[model samples]
Target: MEEVAVVTLEPWHPWPLVFPAIVLATGAVMTFTGHLRERRWVRDIGMVLVVGGGLAGLALLGLLSGSWDQAQRAEALVGLGYEQPTFSGGDGIVGGAPGVIDFHAQRDGELVVGRLVPLGDAQWQVVEGFRDSQPKDSGT
Candidate 1:
């Protein structure tokens, strides 16, 4: 009898983007209302809210930017024929079929490189390498 297992992966949540925007907007409104009412305490409270919201927003923005960068890198890799990309525990896997080829590339102390993985069985081998070539001319 063949055994089958179903694995489900959850989609990425976008609450980080929404939470900060909501907080910032609310804080701005509170600050504006407090200023209009000419209440020092209320104005201070609004300012505090604004600061908190701004910090939260900044944190979320950084996270979003990092995510976007990763996505762009992944897209580029895929475009370059890297298949079945997987990153786990500081290691990455790409392609699969026979056996797995694991390798890492890095430059300097701060410049990190993406890892390339090859897949195939023991008898078969897959390689991950890149070549520089000009784009083909596609007439508009």
Candidate 2:
């Protein structure tokens, strides 16, 4: 009898890309319908909705851009360490296990970080480090 181990690594999801489109569409619908009526409150509500939606859309776009930039950084990090020997004790370990290698880049002056961990023995894989910060920076 023989035993084998299987490991899975999932790619990063870019959800922020769709968020702004949803918000903008909803706001446009509200604004268009409200403009058809003469009620002051209706128009006010519509304007508010439109403004809020625009802000939300912009925020989501920023997040999407940042995420995209981080993805590049993660790829670079993985390539840089792909051939390096796994260190037993160093910046890439946590609780005695093979720790993650964090790659960081600055987008619009804000630091974006990603993590790469050893997926068994095949290759250094990108681990879902954090949405906005590194694991160690998260105080975990």
Candidate 3:
């Protein structure tokens, strides 16, 4: 048995990320990301990072929406025009809670959230996808 999202939520090729989510699931991703974008003074979430990449986005969506999985991930990789993405394992500290971070390649420079929570006055970490995924340089 299989299921598919009616729309790809294709990035930037730019349309607001808020759209498909309306048809999908719930929680802070829809509520918080948009609010942070609206209230730019919020700094931690204000600078808003598009965590992970297209594959990453697909992963988050797959978890939240439940109707998506490997098939969607593969198609989304194509949609993003990324070839042969190697998916490493990522697990959240809290089960069902996604981690928010400072990477944007997943959304084609658009802001879609993978993690959302109260960043509460902590300094933000801006780690772009390539850097985050790269093995820490042995020399460093």
Q: What is the lDDT of every predicted structure here?
A: 0.48, 0.51, 0.36
Top lDDT prediction, candidate number: 2
Report the Cα lDDT for residue 34, model 1. Answer: 85
Extract clashing residue pairs from model 1.
Answer: 97-120, 98-120, 98-121, 99-120, 99-121
lDDT, residue 19, candidate 1: 77
The deviation in Å at residue 43 for candidate 3 is 65
How many clashing pairs per prediction, in order? 5, 2, 4
Instruction: For candidate 1, report its TM-score.
Output: 0.41
Q: What TM-score fits each model? A: 0.41, 0.39, 0.26
Index of the highest-TM-score prediction: 1
Clashes of 3: 4
Q: Taking the tens digit of each residue's C-alpha lDDT, what string does model 3 give over 56-126?
A: 45665555443333334445544544344333444434554434322223444453222112132322222
Quote the positional error of residue 127 for candidate 2 in Å.
Answer: 24
lDDT of 2: 0.51
Preferred candidate (lDDT higher): 2 or 3: 2
Instruction: For model 1, state the Cα shift of residue 134 in Å.
Output: 23
Better of 1 and 2 by lDDT: 2
